[model samples]
Target: MKQNLLGAIYLSLAASMWGGMYVISKYVLDFVPPLTLVWLRYIIAFVVLFAILKWLERKNENRAPIQKRDWFLLVWIGFIGYFASIALQFIGTKLSDAHTGSLITSATPAFIVFFARFLLKEKLTLRKICSVTLATIGVMTVIGWNINVGTYFWGSIILVGAAVTWALLSVYVKIASERFSSLTITTYAVLFALIFTTPFMLWELQSKDITYESSYVILGVLYLGIVSTAAAFFLWNKGLELMDAGIGSLFFFFQPLVGSFLGWLLLHEKLTFHFFIGGALILAGVLIVTLPTKSVENE
Candidate 1:
């Protein structure tokens, strides 16, 4: 129970941290290219995670061997969580409005619940379903789904793909806990994500037409990699390992609200009133799903 509590706190902190990254990221985008930013961010995150793991190696020295079955799971999570989701998100924000990008990404909890049902065979609880429905309504309100401003070809698809990837990763983590330590799985995932993203990072640096004049870009990269990616994922997976998929995902609903506020506070971005209302609904929906209630019993 103690481990579970720690994990839950870690997950909430991780979720909040990830949510805050948006505000910072929007500021960085002006001076950085998407690919370059991703490259630098991952490099830093990789080093930080490895360093922390190594630093704590003394504690885990007598740890049991990781099961062979879990190795595949870790690699898969690396692909989805760290690389695919992170890269696409960075690119999507760069390609589209940060506001729109966040709205799309907020769809994650809904997707997670869906995937969890089929992939992990998690029971479809009413609270989770209601939470998903409320979040959808909130998202629709947030984005004004009526407003379509983009290449109108593949950009939206790519953004959706990023959300789906993260959702899948969430489900994978839920399933993987049955077989491995949450930290171990997350550790391997980040480690392998770095491995998978490294060559691409190098290749991207070589080929991309990018701006590299400002220190803010470098700072942003370091921040993204070290704080946002490395520390955040570790805590997040730990939380997920400890909590239920529906219950744990309640925190994810906080990302857009945090991101939007950060974008407003730091990036000087404007927020529509509708967005505030949408955000409120999302939170309300998440609450509806995760709250321990007699309503569930009454209904």
Candidate 2:
């Protein structure tokens, strides 16, 4: 129970960091193109995490070498997660409002739940079903009634693709947890992502003008790279290692909660009755997923 609580905290913190990232990214996006920013983020994260991982390996000489199968898994995860998923996320957010991005991507946990069942053989309980349903509705409500798919058609589709890829990444992360340390897995996965993103970054740079002189831009990039990408990803993987994937995913709902708050604070976005109502439902869903029933506890 205690471990579960700690895992929840870790995952929630990760989600919160990512939520805040949208605000920071929105500002940085003005200076950096989407793919370039993503490439830079992975590059920074790779360096930081790799240095730490190397240090740890040096300290612990008994650490086993990585297996070939794990390398394949890690590469696959990076390709789908960083190369495709995050890129899609950035594109979606670039095309849409931060609030809409957060709300639409809030459905990630629902996809994670289903993916966990298939990939990790996680149980599909009635409680989980109800929780996902309620949380999805909450996301819709928070996005408000003016959700015309035709308007932000491409953006919406991209966000949905992001959700799917991220879901797949989460499930695979759980699978990888069985073999490798989260630190090693995260570091190498990010390295692979950097490798994959380099060409795209180069292509993007050809057409986009970059301004690296601004201190604010540097700070924003650092925040996205170190805090959101590196630290949050480690925390998220740690949380998944400690808890069931489906249950742990409830913490992902925190993204919208924090995103909404940051949106209001940073963008001067207005909060409505729908926000509160939807937030309540989202919270309730999280509770239902996290707080096991009496029967489960007894078992």
Candidate 3:
């Protein structure tokens, strides 16, 4: 029970940070291109994570040596989840509209549930199904149904691919947690991601103009690298470590809810009736999965 509570807290915090990330990214992207910004974020995150990992080790929390299979798994997490999924998201959003990207990628939790069932052999309960349904509906309400499918067919497809890859990353992170500490997993996985993203960042630098003169851009990059990437990623991995992947996935609904709120707050975007309605439903869905149930206790 205590573990579940901690997991819930961690997941919620992680999702909330990511929700705020959209606002920060919007501000920072004005100066840095998407891929270049991502690369810098990873580099900063890797440094911070690696330092903490070393500090923990010195405090006698030494990690086990990773096996060859696990190394491959970590690389897969980095490549598919961090590099490929994020790249696809940027490209897809560029091609399509931001609304379509948000709407499509909101399906990530559903995909995570599916992958958890197959890969982790987790049982799919009625409660899980209901939670996902309600949350997905809430996301649709929040984002609206204004999809430009005819014009952005390929972008939509790529967004779907991004969703799938991220789901796979979540499930695999769960699998890896059996053998590794969340800190170790996150640190090493991010290292691999940084390596994979370097070439793309260099290529992007050639074509894109970067504004390094603005203090706002610098601060935004620092916030994204430290708060959103390092802390949020660790919290997410730790949360999944302590809970069922399917249940943890439901917490992802908080991202859109918080993002909408932050958009209104920071960006001065307008809030509508749909936002409140959708936020309530999303909260309810999370509670349905997160609260302890009699059946769950018995199991």
User: Which predicted model would earn the best lDDT?
Assistant: 3
Candidate 1 TM-score versus the reference: 0.85
- The 0-to-1 C-alpha lDDT of every candidate, in the order given, reads 0.75, 0.86, 0.92
TM-score, one value per model: 0.85, 0.92, 0.97
lDDT for each residue of candidate 1 in 1-299, tens digit (9 for 90 to 100): 47645655786678778778876776676776566676667667777766766677767777667677768888999999888998888677667766577667777887887887788777788777777888777877766775344553365667888999999898888888777776667777877887887777677667656665888777777888888877888777778887777567767766666766777777787899978898889878756754455555642
Q: What overall lDDT, based on C-alpha atoms, would model 2 receive against the true structure?
A: 0.86
Candidate number with the higher lDDT (1 or 3): 3
Worst 10 residues of 3 by lDDT: 290-299
Return the number of clashes found in candidate 2: 0
Off by over 4 Å in 3: 296-299
User: Which candidate comes out best when scored by TM-score?
Assistant: 3
| Model 1 weakest lDDT span, ten residues long | 146-155
| C-alpha-based local distance difference test score of model 1 | 0.75
- Report the C-alpha lDDT of model 3 over 1-299, residue by residue, as the tens digit: 89999999999999999999999998888889988899889999999999998988888744577888889999998898888889899989888989999999999999999999999999898889999999999999988878887889999999999999999999999999999889988999899999999998999889998988778889999999999999999999999999999999999989999999999998999999999888888888888878887776432
